[model samples]
Target: MTVVNGYEQSDAEKKLNILNLPSLADEAKKIIPTGGYGYIVGGSEDEWTLAENTKAFNHAQIVHKALSNIDSPDLSTNFLGIDLKTPIMMAPTAAQGLAHSQGEKDTARGVAAVGGLMAQSTYSSTSIADTAAAGNGAPQLFQLYMSKDWDFNKSLLDEAKKAGVKGIILTVDATVDGYREEDIINNFQFPIPMPNLEKYSAGDGKGKGIGEIYASAAQKISEDDVRRIAEYTDLPVIVKGVQSPEDALRAIGAGAAAIYVSNHGGRQLNGGPASFDVLPAIAKAVNKRVPIIFDSGVRRGSHAFKALAAGADLVAFGRPVIYGLALGGAEGVQSVFEQIDHELEIIMQLAGTKTIADVKHAPLTHFNYAD
Candidate 1:
């Protein structure tokens, strides 16, 4: 347990942070602005998919073995050629300044502190340059949103390369934003300025690329675009927001270096299957052609283990990192990563696994209900 400024170490270490993810979320409610908290916690209409995301984990149970070598368990793994201290990385959650004043800068620092990687969002409150600088050149990836402006997108890619980003994760889920009931009810909009887009002068540029394309719907990203993005730069292009085997295969065919299995954290689509539910098939489809990065409904160490067993090469933490930020800034965020990492080690030791590779072979069973 690490001590944070303005928070007593013993109390936070021995008590507050000891609580589970849900409790930390509750604590975030007390700290974050009402609308901001709503945006952070809320999903699409009815939140059925959001509920199902976490609920789907209940269907799988880890089976531990006895009388196996259990001296030291290694949680380290590589993601797309980057050496990570742990298999856990931070997901690209936009508008992080809503959670803390420091925004993505603090989040980067926290992730680097815990020996984890961070995927900085394109719409981050802090600029990509600043976020990368704050992380002190730690292993980082840039999450790109295909903007209506092609020049803007090219400039962003240039900026990301200049920032020394290790990889490029092109988000394919959030094209026009989802219908978030919480944001509507609370009248919540993004709070901080997105300085990253200042170079291109976006947002109010009257780019009607949305409804002008396929079927009068805003912004159509085609497989050719994916292929172009993959070839645009020498950096690895990982296609995020792949939920099905078909999409997974298409992304790989388009030359994606990896597949990110997510449903936009159930924020974009209202009634899609949980990320975990669709992971196995997608992983099988990829057939280890590239790495698989999994996100959505990952709240516990066991959940991460299940994602690994389901074929995710790495698991990312999203809302929980925001909760940690709201609780104690960078230190709190690091503690959250450490806690999950610790629990993951415990699960590994109990399961008689010595490395992350062994996690896939760990015995597992499915249950109809939560135990």
Candidate 2:
């Protein structure tokens, strides 16, 4: 059995004949607690958007070109001025400790090992400084859920800057968490401490629901807040959770360095359009002004290819990475990325795209789906 990034190749091959996402998730399910698995996999009420996030990819078809003399498609690209070995990055998912003991620290190490990027969430179990240390100088971004308390926000940003994060991701979608039925069914509560928020929490939050804790964040996020955070940190700010062109324009107008198109993995709004469904319009609206980071339901290399063709500069995913962590810790996380990048390389060659830039111009056919 071959060992790549600590994952046994034979084990992966024996189980699924490939390092597949669904198979990895099924393996993780056997170990992770029910509440934790639900938190990682389940989306908000009805889950219409959750299903659509991946299903929406079926509507777009990539036209494969023939006779383009490309043997190895390059996956290297840049995001927010940072050069990445692959355009596939890890999206910010909170409470990774629920999946593994080391939490964000282990995640950071795995992403760094693969030359990919990671955005640590404000609700992460590991502290910003510790996670950064674990990365050992990997290019990292801090995802901020602006607190209603201005002092707390400032303190959080201060900690992020001191930790040497490359940028700040201002997540604007989840001011209040959407109704997640799995959480209710399990009567779930955070089983671990969020080191980043521990100092600021007013109470221990015993008996209170996770949604209540999340709702305590500032609900009135505005463009002014965007400008303030950017000015304070003097770091590039990527406005996340944008679902429309208007909001994209507004974010750029507010001095955002980049636009992150996401629907919070369908965890914030139940009936919202899939993140992939809105990328083309938002990309058109941005008009090459800044980089665009996209996430939601990206399960395959072809999915990443489609997003790039639709105007996403970088594609990110969360659930699969967590599943990998649950199964093999940091090594498992690195293996998941390796498999996705390998799949992407094959897809790129099939599509006759030699570089990430070429993927932007790859011809695509769109089919309208009846709602």
Candidate 3:
């Protein structure tokens, strides 16, 4: 039987027959409608950063050692006190319903099945309570976009706390929405009846929708404010979307439990450096004070390994998870996880490593970039 990305051909249907990352993305585009397809794949403006996010991974090469008696590698690790079977979490990407009918619920289920964690976006189609219920008490975090109305954000925080989310990931990069040319061209919008924000709406159609409400209500999230928010909640505060060491240091100074180094999957700030490109410096600045979680352009397990060797405590993915959801809902998401996890296991065995801790701080070199 032909094996593709660790899944056998006989098991193709069970594995979504997704083959590899490129095929998975193509299949997703084929399954989703045109507007949603564009929104899912297109990056901001020139999309240089989107391209770079993946390219930066290509520039770094993972060096593998072959002569060790490692038959099985342990992938388990602890992130902010949550025991994860693998050091992978689903990055908080909004509007999952655009990909599949079940949306965040399906993604959460898939994460739970794999014993991984997920950070739910504030713009999710489902309400926090419903999503928590659907997640069935799986370890989860709530990603926050501070609103112009302090009352609204505070109330949302209260809801997340009550819903039993383990942590709060405060996204600070997207003060304004990125110039998503595809979103404009396709006229893409989040589905109406956003369960999470329904209670906050004026109730008379005074605004366009929740998206508009979010746009108008979003206030600039400051580093100082990050500290205040951490104080407001007993749950851990993780600051996501940080791309610089200085900002990372500031987040750490502000009592952040972790620093999530990301370029918003290259969906925001088209010309910005790739998340991988900026990771080393941020890792250097962080210097183990706080755990560093990374995302952006992690399509394969090799990318995850490279990020780990370079200094990421945990690696996350957004687009691939959405692609999986688009193809076969929760099962597809599980297949994607299985593929990556399988590949990671193989890499660890071949590299003479026996665990997630063994993968970190390995010597990595760049292959094709001219300095």
TM-score of each: 0.91, 0.93, 0.91
Top of the candidates by lDDT: 2
Decide which is better by lDDT, 1 or 3.
1
The lowest-lDDT stretch of 10 consecutive residues in candidate 2 is 7-16
* TM-score-sorted candidate list, best first: 2, 3, 1
For candidate 1, the 10 contiguous residues with the lowest summed lDDT are 205-214
Across 1-371, the per-residue lDDT of candidate 2 in tens digits comes to: 33322222212211112357767778878777787788788999989999999999988999988999888889999887799999999999998877877778888988998999999998887899999999999999999998899888998899999999999999999888889999999888776667777677533333446786776689899999999999999999999999999999999999999999999999879988988989999999999999999999999998999999999999999999888887777887888888899998998999999999999999899888774
Give the best candidate by TM-score. 2
* RMSD list, candidates in order: 5.2, 4.8, 5.9
- Give the C-alpha miss distance for residue 205 in model 3, angstroms: 11
Error of 2 at 89 (Å): 0.6
What do the candidate models score in CA lDDT, each in turn? 0.81, 0.86, 0.80
Q: Higher lDDT: candidate 2 or 3? A: 2
Where is model 2 more than 4 Å wrong at Cα? Answer: 1-18, 202-208, 368-371
lDDT for each residue of candidate 1 in 1-371, tens digit (9 for 90 to 100): 22223311111211135466666887778767786788789898899998899889988889978999676889989887788889999999877877777778888988999789999988787888999999997999999888777788888888899999998998888777677888778755454557765665465212222122111221678778777776786888899999999999998888899999999888989888998999989988999999999999999898999899989999997999888886777887888898888889988988888999999777679768743
Residue 346 in model 1: shift from native, Å?
1.0
lDDT of 3 by residue, 333-352 (tens): 88888888888888788777
In what order do the candidates fall by lDDT, top score first? 2, 1, 3
Clashes of each: 3, 0, 1
